[model samples]
Target: MNKNTTIEEVFQNHERPKKPGALNASATFAWRALLRIRYVPEQLFDVTVFPIIFLLMFTYLFGGAISGSTGEYLDFVLPGILVMTVSMITMYTGLDLNKDIEKGVFDRFRSLPIWRPSVLVGALVVDAVRYLIASTIMITLGYILGFRPEAGFFGVILAVLVLLLFAFSLSWIWTMLGIIVRSEKALMGISMMLLFPLTFLSSVFVNPTTMPNWLQVFVDINPITFVVDAVRGIIHGTDAMSDILMVIYISIGLIVVFGPLTMYFFRNKN
Candidate 1:
């Protein structure tokens, strides 16, 4: 090809690169996210510091008032705090994607021959690491503060798995927003606006009985409440199967609705 050759001519002359398998392509993009974190360790501030602040602030500030003692409150509230914090942080995935789009990183990825949705899949996979880190910090701090799960070690593991799965599904909503939203700041604002009400208004810091009757209706139906209830049950060795199933259904529905919507916008985005 000559220097004067048109892009169309060049493309015509060149053979199409073979697209890699979905797993391989996704793994590569997931590595890209991890590597970005590795070099810019400060990118982890939200996961690291947010958990500590929420755990300390909420436990001390509302502990006695909510449950009559810090010790009792910690046992009741730590699981909710863990769920709220981790769910909120998952919004960062969308913000990061929006930033990448603003910087034209996705443009470069588009030129590659790999599967289109692999980019989103890989980023979500890397997000699991962030969720894991946040969950660990929350649990460790709770244990240090005298919060103990009645369900024992295995149940704690199960609870973490449930949180991770739900968080992962919820992230798809933000992923769609990131692709469609105009800016990272807008995405961040929108995500927080939705999350704040959901987390705080649910059973995170207080029992629904304490809330007004009208608000109690929303709290009872809130999916985050189901997640908090599910986590509490798992940690306390109570029956959580119904709440867990509810969360799973919500997750599947979100993925069913938003997953394709995100990919459609992603494919259409210039």
Candidate 2:
């Protein structure tokens, strides 16, 4: 306890922490994220209110112009909107991590005795729940707006799972950004700037064939387009082998690239 204590003595006196298993450590952090949600219930707004607003607005505003009737457009757009909404909400993983870093909690967490990546994994688990809530709202409201999925309830569930898997993979990219960025605002800005163009420019809003030839090239290759197409296939009970495979490939590619990069920065960042 002396002020003159040497570094060697300090090291000798310090007790090493017993490390928890990966799943246990991650569950701890996941529980912490869920508890924070209870105190800050506004966190639910994006997955709830925002999805509703986007659904109603897009369904009514452009529905007739795009598909000849609101009902017709609702059927076409609902799957796309669901994909976009869940994708947008994935940014929160980065925003929350940035805030934690700024507030100094991230450093404290780093000092804790646990699997390091569990912190990231745990937060991701919570975000998955948020995505589920958003998906449910979009599908339920779509029904009210006459957007029936011919594939029925079971099909809708499959669509939701596919979107969640893609969103989970996408979160790794944001998780890396959150570790690298100086502020939550910067992370949000950069993420939105990238996501808006990808989602809007894809087949989400209109048919790719209707797009200009040049623009159609991008739409045809866009990952969001693949996800939207897969969802539409699931909802309509159609064969979507190519779309589903593409979505899976995109998700795996994201995780393979960003997952390690995020952990590298997370472990080494000052």
Candidate 3:
């Protein structure tokens, strides 16, 4: 036998396929995605700056007009502003996903041995960190501006957790929209089109009682309003248990409905 034939035969007899563990695969993918964010941190500034600017502008411009006193209105509007900021930043999930698809990033992912779900999970985890940072900044800014949460530290923490849960669940909807859309611009347009009505029609800037009867009904039913109201109650200790329960139920329902659908579509698109 030739020297090359002898070496090939020897290795071929001992060679065995190596199987990747589920945990290893997931960790590797998660690390890769996290490192991407670490390398490109400017992406996070959008979440940080927008919330601060909005809070300041609205608090100064309309705070007095809305609540008759800037200090009183800041407390009332801060919770709603927090919710709106989180929701707005979450829209970036779709835009990022759309860009990745357009740039053939999914194809690069396909060439890897990682589990399919790992990709989406990696993205979600990275975005969740951004959301947490943004939330903290908004809350701290509110505090500096005389927005006190009478519910104390523990209650404030719980409220933050609830808001994060709501934001995470809502991200699935935007993630799906981003994947289905052809361009990042289109994705942004579509997400904003849906977000505008949802944001404005809720009890965000103005009290629902100030609206017409029909508008009040819609605002009362809007899920974002419940989230805002629940956070407000947790901070102020003024809202009822029934309202908090409603928010929890609606958030859970959204996760159940959209979470699986997002995964299904993401998998198929990949």
Candidate 4:
């Protein structure tokens, strides 16, 4: 062949780039998101600080009025505070997703030779570490504040697992909202508006018995109530198998509903 023909053949015969492995795509995105957390540790402040503040504020300010003594109320309130903290952390899933979308991060990811779904699932996985850290701090704070878990170490761990599972399931819902909403601030506002009422309307601060019959009925059916009660049962030796089952079932249902919905939206957006 002539020199020019040989050069053209050489260029044409060069190997094409290989696609990234599925597992590699997932792991790369997961680790990249997680490493970002180390650089911006302040993202964790709300997770650690909010629980402590809420625990102390509620126990000291209204404990006696609500439960007859600060000590007695701490026992009842800690579980609710723990659940609230997990719920608050889930809001970040949507907020961060919205921020990424706004910044064209998803478009950048699309250009990569990786599984597109990995970007979302990996973010959710990485955020679980933050969830664990927040949970450990909250549980430790409870222990230091004279809140004892009658369920012992294993039960406490189990309760934490359940709480995290619930958080993970809820993340999908927030992920969908984050992608659907046009702005991060709007996502945060809407999430908090929905969460605040769900949390407060339940038996978090006061006994449901004190509420009106109509409100009491609603509180009884709130999923957050079931989660809080399950945690309290595990820690305080209250029989909560039924409540635990309810939480498990509801969490599974949420995953079933939101997981597919998120994937659908994500694919369409891409």
Candidate 5:
């Protein structure tokens, strides 16, 4: 007879470790997502490179045309660019989800006994970190290029918080699309269609007051306009209570609407 401990005896001798709770499972998943960044460093290009390009290009190319000077426009548009850069990056959430689904990892994720929402929630948690990274890069480049916030670092913090809340809420729509969309190409097309009009038609590049009444009406109702105004107010030390409130309301509404939709489809997806 074998004197060495067998697998059966080892199993009998050791109690099973405690099962992970919802928060723990979600955090573990988030860490896994973070580790993915190591092998696919290119995944960070949008969050890293695009913000810098938008700030420099928009400030130099369109600055004189719109705001009469690059310095003034940098002060005016840095907040808007920050919002745009982060907002645009949110689409990648859907793209990545669709990729995982195609690769069949989501099926493995689903089979686990962990909390059902942990997968999506974990991705969103890591995405918040990405948003912060994009904000930091943009702000640092802004400083180098002479953009100054009147409300200073604290105000920058507040503005980024609002932006992150909105961005996280906005990501749910893409998450749903990722689960439902047939192909990544179609998803990218849909994202471009939605994002271009939303970002370009708002107050980011030009003031709505300078446009025709009809265009102004559309701009006034545009949700991006409210976010930009809120950030602008926070950064410039102005009274933007209404815009801030609007952003909060919109973020809550987005989460309430799309959050459940994402989970429903995720549970039912083929």
Candidate 6:
């Protein structure tokens, strides 16, 4: 039986793995991304501690000056701070991608028999989880600090869902940069340069009307201004349908522009 074994006998193996579908492939990659968090627990510090720090520091430091009382400013700034915190941290997506490429991890992933975009798709999923964690931390602390959403819990949920959608679209821009840029540090540098103006110069901290004419123009056109307005409106019970729709439109535009670029560089990457 041993010596007479033919090629047909050897070829008749039953344990060959069927290729995973897109969702299954994506979930597997998502698990891999989560394990990195398990091994390097510091990955969570941004989503957890930074939200607390940003909330407390900005609320206490500028609250009275801006709104005449900490309580009043807390109501206004909490939603703004939530957007700022999550948006700032979205750069980590690019940083992680660049790190993987530099370490040649992407090479091994590309050689595998799996849906290719699942790597980036899985990253987007994990970042959404991180963004939700940051949003929850910030909002919960806001509630303890005398902040209340006049639109109540339903509005809070709606605002968060909108925020998560915008963040998902925004990640594609960073993902494209991550594939195009050569180093993680460079990716971070460019991301901050883009994020600072978009967060600070927008209506996150103050009304765009309070800004100078030229600055107001940028603030008016800034996509984040619409997002912050939409979120703040949801919390305050103001009509924000137009702003919400603008945020959605902007999100669609970003995905249309950057999603393909990210994939193009990823596939053609040297």
Candidate 4 lDDT (Cα, 0 to 1): 0.87
Kindly state the number of residue pairs that clash in model 2: 0
TM-score of each: 0.93, 0.93, 0.89, 0.92, 0.95, 0.95
**Displacement of the residue 243 alpha carbon in candidate 3, Å:** 2.9
Off by over 4 Å in 1: 1-18
How well is each residue in 187-241 modelled by candidate 2, as lDDT tens digits?
A: 9899999999999999888989998899999989889999999999999999988
Model 1: which residue pairs collide?
none
Residues 1-270 of candidate 3 have per-residue lDDT tens digits of: 466687668777866557666666767766876787789978878778988998999999998888889999898888888888888888887777778788898778767766776766667777777888888898899889888889888877878888888888888888888878888888888888888888878977888999999889889888888888888888887864776788678778877998788778877884
Tens-digit per-residue lDDT, 1-270, candidate 6: 389889788789566778999999899889989999999999999999999999999989999899999999899889999999999999898889889999999999999999999999998899999999999999999999989999999999999999999999999999999989988888989999999989999988998888899899899999889999999999899999999999999999999999988888989998
Look at candidate 4 and give me any clashing residue pairs: none
Candidate 5 regions exceeding 4 Å error are 1-5, 10-17
Give the least accurate 10-residue stretch of model 6, judged by summed lDDT.
Answer: 8-17
Cα lDDT, model 4, residue 185? 82
Task: Encode model 5's per-residue lDDT on 1-270: one tens digit a residue.
Answer: 268878888768767667779999999989888998878999999999999899999999999998899999999889989999999999988998999999999999999888999999999999999999999999999999998899999999999999999999999999999999989998999998999899888998777899999988889999999999999999899998899999999999999999999999999998
Q: List ranges where model 4 is wrong by over 4 Å.
A: 1-13
lDDT of 4 at 258: 93
For candidate 4, give the lDDT of residue 249: 96
Pairs of residues at least 3 apart in sequence or in different chains that clash in candidate 6: none
lDDT of 4 by residue, 55-80 (tens): 89999999988888999999889888
Candidate number achieving the greatest TM-score relative to the actual structure = 5
Residue 70, model 3: Cα distance from true site in angstroms:
0.9
Give me the displacement of residue 240 in model 1, in angstroms: 1.4
lDDT at 82, model 3: 84
